[model samples]
Target chain A: MTSQGVWTPEVVADLLLTAESSRTPVGSVTGRWPDFDLAAAYRTQDVGMKRRTARGERVVGVKLGLTSPAKQRQMQVDTPSVAWLTDAMELPPATVVPRSRLIHPRAEPEIVFVLGEELAGPGVTAARAMHAVSAVLGGIEIIDSRYSGFRFTLPDVIADNNSSSRYVTGSVQVNPDGFDLALEGCLLEVDGQVVDSATGAAVLGNPAHALAFAANQLAERGHALQPGWVVLTGGLTEAVPLAPGSHIAAHFSHLGSVVIKAD
Target chain B: MPTGLAGQHDSRTAVLNAEAAERLLAAYAGGEPAEPVIERHPAADVSDAYAIQRAQVVRWIAAGDQVAGYKVGLTSRAMQLQSNVDQPDYGHLMRSMFAPEHVPIPATMFIQPRVEPEVAFVLSRPLRGPGVTIADAVCAIDCLLPALEIIDSRIRDWRITIVDTIADNASSGAVVLGGRPVSPRAIDLRLAGCVLYRNGEIAATGVGGAVLGSPLNSLTWLANTLGPLGVTLEAGHVVLTGSMTRATPVAPGDRVSASFAGLGSVSVQFAPEQQEAAR
Candidate 1:
């Protein structure tokens, strides 16, 4: 009787969780773990999220990684990967994030949606998907790689939940009807200097399409986006580094601004 | 534990619209606020909120109420964070909503009322717009008057989301307009400044540019936003050009006033609890 499996989803999830909890970085899983594939990667993500939920962390929303073509090319992936966000990952407004708890963190500005209704799909269009959105807010995502040098393959990242660390949303939540979201602009600033800038179009042409894709992708897994859930579409511009006492801010064209400082 | 949930969005939307409108209407009639409607109407979006607002307008018109004007809300950055909404929204000002200048208003007329200083635009001619310009809006104006908007919430403790405030008529309660009316071109409206005082103490200071780069732009935005929907800024209609500073709280017997640099000054008082003002 064989009682051992080295590359099972549960085992991979356990190893990833252990490394994540200790704030330690590990190498890529490619060629190291046998039977490691994309489907198994997704299963590992699901199992990891389940363990988090079991520990009393509520799933607040979902986040998309590698949504942009440039990001996909850099990661050598054609499709984006999805990850779950828990309440424990939320950073309250005006609170400084302590960098000592993180191995290395980079910040990206995002277009976030707070859904007003359930969005389920497989054949959903961006126009139809927007009907479910209530408000849009500027968001900052802290993406930390649990893998060394932030180097990982597609399956490696999907299993690691795209290295999500924490997120903070702006105080302002505006109705999406107020502006053309595709042209929505954002400026990523560090220490009061503009470091990066990108429009909403950078995120998969339009963020709404990414949202539609998210809904369709969730449907594939027998899940759906529910009301009041916050969806982080994806990072719009290249991420910038975080250091102690750095004044970081993302100013959006119409969605107001979100500012954070690293302590 | 769940099954298919497709093709039912339309019917589900209507139910949410009706339920949202009903609660807000009840709160309006009883002069008492309700719990935040967003919690109960999970599917209410901005469009759904506007639909609820329009439904109430219909009912109010049927009840012999006359449309007075329009009031814009959440114009400044500070106001955005205060109310937790990013973009601006507007509400209708019924004929019954205007309070006389320098008169004491009854406290019971509103629930958790706060005051805002504004530059009121009383239109001279009807303005229709899909692409209305700033000049067109300035040309339509008869005059600008110093004004105070008594903003009240129909959501308990002002725990409002965007849907909640829009459904409650942009958190509007009463308008107090006064001061010597000045021609639109008599002064640089963008640079116009004002000092708001509450009970003989300076409360807030701001300039006209605080409202969407100028109250003129806000006027054009209103005309353009509503014109596509078939709403016009009619002649003699008073357009409250949004708040210039953060809204300050008001209580019974409290006196509040605002002095504008070139537009003169206006004031209002909240009468002590004795009897409700004539409605």
Candidate 2:
């Protein structure tokens, strides 16, 4: 236990990375720091990214969390938050899950946007957001909170990079043009049994709106989505707990399905 | 045939004279800048300059370039004082004029190119002039971006008056917009500041208020000025509202960057001229 006011961004990032590598959950840092604002959280995330890059992990793009109303309510937060994703987070399709690495991992289905051009925002609309997208694909994110009991505050989650651990993308890529994304549905199945299903509209009414929101959010921090960057729009349904030897798959209406074997 | 009596010419003769002036201006634009048109025709005013600009715009359109938006120049009191112009001027921006940041621009395409730091407004809604106010302008704006406008004079040695510049499309050349887009309501335009760097050294510094009191004021002026011409500042158009700092000349291999206080920074580099191809 350290002094409440002694946790700088570097110290906090170090503590989180230690917890992540050891696969051991730590107590929430929210109460330890006084007035830990969003800026401080983002700074901590930046430090964590530097630490990751130093370890030879390259940033692929970003992810949005707590975008859906249900997810926001579940997290007790009114607004959504962003997190960075590194290339190391990607898992090969149909590969067995690395259970030894993650702590109590959970899976959620997501829609991913592959950008064709750079997009900056403050006033990015859904219609204009589509023009920047090159393709849409189905994806599954494996979330593993570094905090004990998977319970944390907004700042805590942000500092943990939104509990991002691993991801697997679908093989099929569909062009976004003229595609009715709002009506695009996904079925989440576990061990060959349908557990949950949702539409693209489950993510902030539409997934494109999520992308626009991401652009506007990044603009607040003097950043923008670049060409070839993959953006993960938030999860569609409640994350299902992953157990060893279980098979998880998500089938999309337009985009093809993605399957992962947990071992 | 007397110079003073030329104003009393018949409507047919006036039309023919305008056509001839357009032809002369187009020829100059396609080739090299020669003597100022105002020096040859003392009767030419700002309106006549704009008419000539319209003819140049038609030529650009015919060349397969689309009109992106407009830019306001000579808006700052310092610029007006330096250029000896009492009022602001406007120019058209073609899609080709927009350059990506960090990209090296070819120097051979320009004549005596100079750069200035500016604040750009990206419109989200259409705004027309006459009754347009600052509030209307603000509401219509989607975001503000830091930008560097490359102004190149076609006129020889840039020795031209207000009429000459306006006729030469307000000496417009290229623009590089910053990656970050800030909401107009996020920061006070009057208080925003910028530091311009040339070749990695600070060349100039300025605040947003330097542009016609504020960039919002410049935008309002633009909306109102275009109203009577039946032109509206369309949605998604990027409007550059004059420069905060004086124009700085750049040589090949020189890199220029401007960092705005709230709206991030934008940079551009000039590449060495390519070897002339043999005929």
lDDT tens per residue, model 1, A1-263: 12334677787787788778888887777647756888889988999999999989999889999987678879888888889999988999766886888878889999999999999989889998889999999999999988888888889899998888899999988888745665565756788754555556667767898899889998998889989999999997778888878988887766777999998
- lDDT per residue as tens, model 2, A1-263: 65565778899899999999999898888867757767889899989989999999998888999987767877788778888899999998877889778888999989899999999999999999999999999999999999999978888999999999999999989999888665565767789755555557567767898899889988997789889889989997679999988899887766878899888
**Candidate 2, residues B37-57: lDDT per residue as tens digits?**
666666677777787778778
Root-mean-square deviation of Cα positions for candidate 1 versus the true structure, in angstroms: 20.9
- State, as a TM-score between 0 and 1, how close model 1 is to the true structure: 0.51
Q: Any idea what lDDT model 1 has?
A: 0.83
Candidate 1, residues B1-279: lDDT per residue as tens digits? 223344467667778788877888888789778888778888788888888888878888998988889988877755676667767888989998999986778878788999998999999999988999988888999999999999998889999888888888888899999968999989766545566678986566555766776788778888988999999999999999988766789998889998776788899999976545433
Off by over 4 Å in 2: A1-263, B1-31, B274-279
Judged by DockQ cut-offs, the docking class of candidate 1 is incorrect
Give the CA lDDT, 0 to 100, for residue B70 in model 2.
91
Give Cα distance to truth, residue B137, candidate 2, Å. 0.5
TM-score of each: 0.51, 0.49
